[model samples]
Target chain A: MSWEKVFFALLIFPGLLYAVPTAWLMLWLERKFRARMQGRIGPPFYQPFFDFVKLMAKRRVLRPSFDSIFMMGLPLVSVSAGLLALALLPISSDSRGFAGDLVLLVAFLEVPSLCSVLAGFASRSIFGQVGATREAILSITYNLPFLTAIVALAYSAQSLRLVDIAASPAGGVRALAVLTICLCLPVKLRINPFSVSNAEQEIYSGPATEFSGPQLAMWELAHGLEWVALTGLVVCLGLTFRTGTWIGDFAIYTSLSLVLVILLTILATGTARLKIQQAARFYWRWGMGLSLVALILGVFPDIERFIR
Target chain B: MNIFSVLLKNLRMGPATLRFPEEVPYPKGFHGPVKIHTEKCICCGMCAYVCVSGAVRVAEHKDNCEWVYSPGLCTFCGKCVSVCPVEALHMAAKSAPSYFNTKALDEVHLVPYSPCPECGRPTPPVREVLRAKAFKGVAPNVLVKSLICQRCRQKDSQRALVSIQVKGEPPPSRSDK
Candidate 1:
């Protein structure tokens, strides 16, 4: 690809422009769906946009002890990582994918959480410190099962390239790996049951307590972009069907993303927030157990063949 | 609770959101903004006195009285509406739309006043004073007598007492008869 085309792909298509809006839509969908389930009229469709703008327009306030550079830079890093991860995903047959991009994708996915830890530490607030500590603990607890699930999927495809794994035919092992992904997703995204790091009631927005104005706006935007990237990962891994045309394939991918968002929203609404220790224990026990089973199943081709 | 059943039921019932701004039909008896009928206002300052938040201000100037309603400070308690003797104040079904500017929520109603007949001192708006007198069931002559300033009314009462003592309680006046 030409430099210009690459830049366009990274900055516009399947990048910031695309991911940000989709992420905002996911936020709206989450709120609206929860409201409907509870028999209440939710916010308007443009509410997310309004919130983003309002946050951006607010005056920036920083404590004297805060490291402004680190506090502000982390969210930008998160956004870049999310966009880079999305760019690596094969939305169409012509999309770029290098060997071992699955590992890169996983690294990119974890960078945002790492950034959150750094941001919390830099904020110099007690709540931020506590939030950072919780996030750091969560990262360690959730990363193992999340990586194991990906490894299991890679083992099933017998390739480390995302496109190859996605294009490969469905199998029993891949299905099990997909199930493991589903179980781990809530923890990774910090959905209701696993949202200990930023529990608003307990920690007051946790890492985000001290962030204000445009810096906070950027953090929220990064969060939205992260949602798109993660949901896209699930779509690529689980569905992965193509119609031989880029447009048709993208349409299928978009629909799969929508379905995943709806499913995630339902899961989020149905559960209560788990304490940090509870979340850690749950991930270590059930999440690890499921991914391990899927991993063992992926290792044995004969069993998958028999099951199919 | 089974989440799937809830989800299915909601889906069947359709979306719960109202298309607001276009179709926001306020519920019946909704305690929204307080409405003031300027013509019926008695300028008794009762609404302002009862307003716990001080959202309603009755300013009496030399020549005029100003009634200011600050919707921003209002808690929608409906106390002012209930306390209004002339039934001028009411809770409207429509609420004041949220404004980006604070000044937009302030409403000022200016009413001109009349001077007391005896002392020529400025009083509250003539229409409101008359309305209040009529609401209190005062006869026309007594209503006219009430329009004088407090000092002037005391002087007149003292003069009447002096005349009664001097004339040894003469026969009732024509109007009384």
Candidate 2:
């Protein structure tokens, strides 16, 4: 691969330049959708962007050495992981992905959660530690199905590279895997019903309780990028459409992500937050059931045909 | 109702909230700006007396009294409205009108003084409401007596004292001692 092409992939289309603005817009759109669902006039279109600027303009407060270090470093680390994952996803079918790129994408996706857990512990606060512990537990809980779904998709395609996965036509097994991934998105994004890790009421914003000023802004940016990465992954998987040009595919990707945003917002607005135990139970039962079925069908292709 | 149905209804109903720049409907008995009924005022200065913020000023002139109220300075405490002996001052039920300049928001009501009946001096005119209140149980002559200026009333009292004759035995006086 040429360095110029790699540079274009990392910093231009589907990179930081395109992803940042789209991330902010998606965040705004989700909030707007939630507001409309609740019969209220939501924020203006520029709210998320304005919020980032406002937060960045605030004065940074100094803290103890231990809490200080993580506060400075963790958001950078977390956001980098999210950005890298976004760049790796095959939003367009022409992405030059290699073997085991799916596994690498999954690893990059997990880094933010790991950083959040570490950030919580480093805060040296009761609420933060509780949040960190919940985050760790939820990570494990959600990953069971989350990883299994990706594995199932990889198995169905018979290749671990995202480009090959995109090349593979979706089947009944792939359909089940998509459903399994959909079930995990709410938890992955910290939306209600699965937001136990950062329960604002119970745990005071969870791991992010102590963050303020520009650090908090970074956290918010990371979250927005996470939206793009995770939803983009789903969109890339479920609707593998090619419209001749990358721009057309990019447009389709954006439109599908917004549609996904609306769906998630509805789910978030409808349900109250579940307790950590209840969330764990939910995943272990329904989520695990779907993932196991998909994995089983992938291992033995005869089962799906028998069911049909 | 189920959340999905509620969401659908909300989607259909639009927002129940008032939009930005739209004025909220005033509630009943909301305390608004101070307004004066010029004719009913007796120039007693009670509103001015009770005004903590000095929003109300009663300027007494020989020919007239100017009742000036600055809504910009008003704290909307409703004290002036409550203490007006002659129910002339009242709080408006609606919001105060917008003003380009706070200096122009001063409301001046003229309380003209009529010439006194007994003495030709200009005296603050009392309202009929005050008249009926003060002379509630008295006869018609009291109305005539009350309308005279204060100086004339004092002179009449002195003259009445001079005309009265002594009726009792005199006590031992210092001069006799």
Candidate 3:
């Protein structure tokens, strides 16, 4: 097969199929993981699918004053953007992998979150308004450190192509850039310390309170896909140990992804939600500082050579 | 010491939350409502007076005895039954009284009292329940009286006998009066 066909078959098609179950599975797994951490028995594996079916059977009741059109539009766009971003990630050496430039992938990954803020804002309730503001602030703060780290890597590699960057010189400045991306995963996924927007206690599920029935299901599906996609992206950035074979690469990548998912799920369960301002402060002070240091390390090859 | 204690404490679990609507059992000591044994009440106002929650309201009209019980205010203390001179009150384990309005809590009942057919004496409800309990094993069937107060017993007896002697049958006594 030609490289273009290989890319479409390997990355885009599998990525699309992978997005559905991965999102659905992550949601069920998250509930189960969270329950285990909190010393409770959570729902079963098919719980998320059951929840979607149950929601589909439910009647939708919109508040008279709510902006129904915008509320309906938000979740659909969010999940589509997440799945599209997943399609852009290069999980294997394939034809369609080059379709998504790293910059474009980053922009697509952010669309769902941006739409979340819009969803919250359109509801016009006090809680919804506050939640939208929080989501907007968090998005800006987390994405800054994230994009800075990505740009630093892109600068060093001389290519915004994700596969090309992945195939770059291993165990060098590129390696640190890859690690920085790994650090960025949890923030993009909006796990603890960064989970100010959807904190259940402080905001009553915040941006998602007014979301119910099918719209709510879409948001949940997006969240699940986003989880697996972020983890897959981390693995794609050359964080694997393979013997130059497809089977070896697949085994290594899948194992590493599973490990990363487990670690993050544990972290999510262990931590409590922080205030919005506290989260912003954390991202600005520590998150930005660490990512900047990584970026600086990735840029200064002479320093790396001198140290070696 | 601290580390071991912390580990042990974390290992210890919180109160188990009951599975609602399925594995849930009724709570202990669930005294739902007050039941009246009409013959046992003496109209002494003791139940009304002694009740700290004021759950029971008793009013003795000229011809009728009235009893009002508020299930909401009643903590199910069972104090009213204990203080009842005539043993009129019994704790209803099942059948709780419930309503949307607070005013609906006031449910009044008119207790039935049996006076003696011959003597016309009032029979206390407590004594009757106790008698029923005591004699159930001994007597296969027992007819108990629950009408007329203790004072009217002799008058009713004399009037009955006199009517039978004069009319060669029983006569109605003081129909208007």
Best by TM-score: 2
Better of 1 and 2 by DockQ: 2
Over B1-177, each residue of candidate 3 has an lDDT whose tens digit, in order, gives 543343234336532444554555556665767878665666667888988888888876645568888887887878888887557778876656457887785788776444555464444333655556544444221222223445554565676788789768856433233
> Which of 1 and 3 is ahead in lDDT?
1
* TM-score, chain B, each candidate: 0.73, 0.82, 0.49
Model 1: which residue pairs collide? Answer: none
C-alpha lDDT score of every prediction, in listed order? 0.82, 0.87, 0.70
Off by over 4 Å in 1: A1-13, A16-18, A31-66, A94-96, A302-308, B1-4, B14-177
Per-residue lDDT value at B88 in model 2: 90
Instruction: List model 2 lDDT by residue over A69-110, tens digit each.
Output: 889899999998998898888877667777888999999999
- Candidate 2 structure lDDT: 0.87
Clashes of each: 0, 0, 19
User: RMSD to the native, candidate 1?
Assistant: 5.8
Interface RMSD of 2: 0.6
Candidate 3 displacement at residue A57 in angstroms: 2.8
Which 10 consecutive residues of model 1 chain B have the lowest summed lDDT?
A: B168-177
